[model samples]
Target: MSVTAVIRKNSYFDSVSLMSISTKANGIDGVDQAFVAMATEMNKAVLENLGLLSDELKAATTSDLMIVVVPSEGADGDELVPLVEELLVRKAPAAGSAEVSHRTIASALEEDADINLAVIAVNGAFAAREARKALDAGLNVMMFSDNVAVEDEIALKNLAHDNGLLMMGPDCGTAILNGVALCFGNAVRPGTVGIVAASGTGSQEVSVQVHALGGGVSQLIGTGGRDLSAEVGGVMMIDGIRALAADPGTEVIVLVSKPPAAETEAKVLAEVANAGKPVVVYFIGGSRDAVLAAGGHFAASSADAARQAVELSSAAASAPETLDAGQVDAVLARLTPEQVNVRGLFCGGTLCDESMYALLNDGHEVFSNIQKNPAFQIGAADSSRGHTFLDFGDDEFTNGRPHPMIDPSNRLARIVEEAKDPSVAALVMDFVLGFGAHEDPAGVTLPAIREAQRIAQEDGRHLEIIAYVLGTELDTPGLDAQRKALAGAGVTVTSSSTVTGEFARAIARKGAAA
Candidate 1:
């Protein structure tokens, strides 16, 4: 086996486009594994873990792009670096498309009077400035960049509110506007249910569940994850609630997020009380009584929220599906006496939080990087003690890298790492599908999954893998195909995020007894 590393000085590419390059490089023949990313400290550590960090790359800066490829035995690794670099070359513009380029937001708006929204995905330092420009131009803004200062976020959101323009996020990842899915959002039918969420994957799971329940969404607005924090004060949340309340097409509303600050929750619930339409609320670890007193229904999970919204919207929903007991028993039957913990490697933060909450509620001690209690926090990124659920999309993992949804390299590495642990009984995860997600998430992650199972079998233990795909039949890599692929790999693919958590809990409970 041979490893090759190449670096391009001062080269830069957005996370989304770089994902494409990484995907293409891995598909090349003779390649065993590929790592293509900017040489940030975190990325260098990842490369070091993969045994691909060369001496020259160790000195590379964040502005430098690094490509590392490991070639299979007998294959020439030296010849692969140039080929990988070729993937970075931008494709030529199609005929007549060259004239459409705009130098700034003002230029674009001046040229196209119909442009009403600007999607900002620059570095966090420059994100606020661009968002401010869009707001000044009377355009609604959806900022996808993270790492912006809290003060800048508050100022931008306040300006947007004062101008009567919608400000979606400083780190917002998903939204569905006018039947069009935007930035990591799933494809779903357009109908009466409207959603306002401070969680990206949380909103996604609810919207997909609503679609599965025979109801549809009119609009799914995202108010960046920090909207409900005390500092930000739920600016976009209140604005989103008002927008959906007055929307004629919306008859039922759903609000999803982790619990907000006490004052913020009260303000949001007060708004819900006067929505003049049925509302379903699902806030992780939040107060159900507060929702009930505010005249809104409280949902126990994402699936429950969708069911309530469907019923409130008067949609002809189908009966909810039940998990197969036989399948659960079959998995638990194979676990060894020493195997007892569930290690969830998740791409979606909300999905991770939901599963952790489910395990904790069932008397299982779940340790995670997102843990609220200091007692349950994992010691390190690679550490998994008891039941550990790690959200790979957390800032520590994604600070200067692409989210795991778009690039599964980090998660793929962690899968093998976790499998080497003797106490790990089951692996729980999520495959997010839709517009900005990977083209085929299951297809890309299958090799790692197979390798993990191989390691467990060699150790004479069974590794139960449970997964939930958050998407619909309408998504690019449709739900049915992704689930089918995983099921073929002997994975237990649950019907919903809630079911996925339940399945993991069942394994954890049985493993504990073993």
Candidate 2:
């Protein structure tokens, strides 16, 4: 194998675009692995871990763009640099077309006075400054950049609250405004239900579920993951609630989060009581009684939250989707008595939490990196015990690498690693399709899935892989095609995240009995 590094001095590209370039480069015929990213400290550390860091890479400044490739035998790694450069070339507008690209927020607003919202995706160190400029310009802000100081977030949110404008996030990853999906969201249909969520995947799962149930969303607002923490105090959640309540198009509201701080929860619930519309609350492991007392409906899961919101808006209940009992039995029949553990390698953090909760509620002991109870936490993230569900998008896994959704390499590697264990029987995962996510999530992960199964089969064991594709028909990659591909691979594809968890739980339970 040959390793090559290409460094461009003082070049900068957003992480998302770099991740896309990296994925494309890895798809090259002879490339074993590729890294296309800015030479930041975190990224350099990632290169070191992979043993791909050359002296040139180490000497490159953070401002420099780095493209490193490890090519297979007989593959010329140097020949691939031109192809990477071609992908980096930004496409210009068609001849005679009147498209304009502005370099600054002020320039954009000047070009179009109707622009009311500013989407900021920059380094966290400068994200606050950029957000402040937007808020000062009388525009709503959705900051996709994480790592901004908590104090800066508080100040910016307060400024927006005083101005009666929306401040969506410091690390907000999903939202739908006026029926338009923005930054890591599904193409959901518009209707009477509105959502204010502090969790990204939780919002996608709920909104997609609503669409599947003959209901649609009026709006899906994101209040970055930390909005409900004691420090942030649910400022944006309260703002989102008021906005949705006042929206004539929104008749039923849904709130998604992983349990807010006590005082923060009270503040948010107080707003819910005054929403004057039906509100469905799902807080992972929150109290149902508190929601009931607040005149809100408590949801048991993300899917349940969607169902309640849809039923409230449409006044019609759809029959619940059921797990295929015969299929479950067939999968169980193939499993050996010694192979009794379920390992979930997920790209979506909220989906991981929801699945863990499902297994725990089913009287199964679940260990996870995100588990709050110390008893259920794993000593080492690299190994699994009993039923384990991991959120690969967590900070530990993503500090230097892109999210697993953006780049499935880490999760794909973990799948093969877990399959090597003789005790593993089933694998659960999620394929999140939408804007700003992987272009072909299911298609890209298929090879790894097949490889993992092959290893188990060669060892006289059967591995069952269950997955849920969280998307809609209108998504860019299209949900049907992704599902079809996975099903064709002999993998069990469930209808929803909750159902995926339930299905895995059943398989694990059956394995335990055997």
Candidate 3:
């Protein structure tokens, strides 16, 4: 193996561009791994962890762009430097067509004082500082960067609250304000349903469902994932509820989160009860009765939340589509006796949690890398036992690489591994579509899905690949086309994660009984 590093002096690219370049380089033949990033301290640490850092890279300043590549045995490593340069050139904006760019919050504000929101996507260590500048300039914040200190988040939120402004997140990924999608958001029609979610994909899933149900969204607010915890006190949740309640365009408000602390849940429920507008709450593992008792509708899943929200706002309802009993039976009958367990590899953490709960509710002994119960937690992320569900988008899997949403390479590799296991009965996954997500996610994974199926078939085993695509028809990578691509690959594609999980559970139960 060989390692190479190049530092571009005084050159800078956004994190997303660097991540895309790194992902592209890592996918190159004979390349073991790659790191393309600004020389920020956080990124430097990532390079060190990957063992790709060099003395030159260590001395590089944050203004420098660093490209490090590791080549596997027998690989022509010399091509790496030229390849990195080529990718950078291709990714850069055209010389004469470049739009105006801002180097600081003050300068951006100077250019457009009407700018109401600032979306921060810098390194975590510098995120808070930039966010504070934005807040000081009277701008609402949508922080797309993670790894921010909790104390900084608390301080920023409190400051926003004091100024009667919104501070969305330090790790928030998706939000739609008025009618504009921001940072990792989807394009949906403007309507009466409004959402405030703590999970990125959760917001997308519910909003897309609302669109499909003939309803539109007025606003979508993301409070980051930690807003509902005891430490954060659900500050943004209550504020978002209040804001939407007062917005004349929003007839119904929906709240989504994985689960909240007891005190935080109670506080949010109190706000929901008092809000003049009807509320739909979908706390993935929270008590449904609690929401009802608080004068709100409780949804069983993200799709259900959107359905109920639409029903309340416009008296429209869309029945969830799921596989019939016969379809389930046929899939089970085709599986070999050795294929008895279900393997769920997901890019959405909330979806994975919801799937695990759905399987447990259906009386399956499921394990997951993200499960809170040690008994049900997989001992190793790379290994699966029993009916296992893994979140490839988790921080543990994304430490040095781009998120699975932006780069599906890791999940694709895992899919192949799961298919090779004789005990794997089914492979269930999610494909997220949006502005910052992969352009052609399903197209990229189609080959891997075919290969996995072929590997299973060659061993005289059957593999059931069930998936759900989360996005609206209006997204760049059209939802319909993505689903069509998956379906064309002989994969069962659904519209909801809940339905997908239920289908996988049904197959697993039937296979076990067989």
Per-model TM against the reference: 0.90, 0.94, 0.94
Per-residue accuracy of model 2 over 1-514 as CA lDDT, tens digit each: 4788899998877666776777788888888877788888778998898788888899998788998888878888888777777889989999998998888899999999999999988767678999999999999999888878999999999999999999999889999999899989999888999999999999999999998888899999999999999999999999999999999999999999986898899899999889999999999888899999999999998889988898889645576577788888888888888988999989999999988888788788888988888888764245888889999988788766677888787788888888999989899999999998999999889999999989998998888899999999999799999999999999999999888888888877876677
- Residue 487 shift from truth in candidate 1, angstroms: 1.2
Cα lDDT, all candidates: 0.88, 0.88, 0.86
Q: Tell me which of candidates 1 and 2 scores higher on lDDT.
A: 2
Which runs in model 3 stand beyond 4 Å of their true positions?
9-12, 27-32, 40-51, 58-64, 71-79, 89-98, 379-381, 511-514
Candidate 1: residue pairs that collide: none
* Greater-TM-score candidate between 1 and 3: 3
lDDT of 3 by residue, 85-175 (tens): 7888844457897466778989978888898988888878788999999899899999988889999999999999999899999789899
Q: Which numbered prediction scores highest in TM-score against the true structure? A: 2
- Give lDDT: candidate 3, residue 274: 86
Top candidate on lDDT is 2
Query: How would you encode candidate 1's per-residue C-alpha lDDT over 65-171 as one tens digit per residue?
Result: 88888987777778887788889987767987855766689889778989999998865657899899999889999988777889999999999999998999988
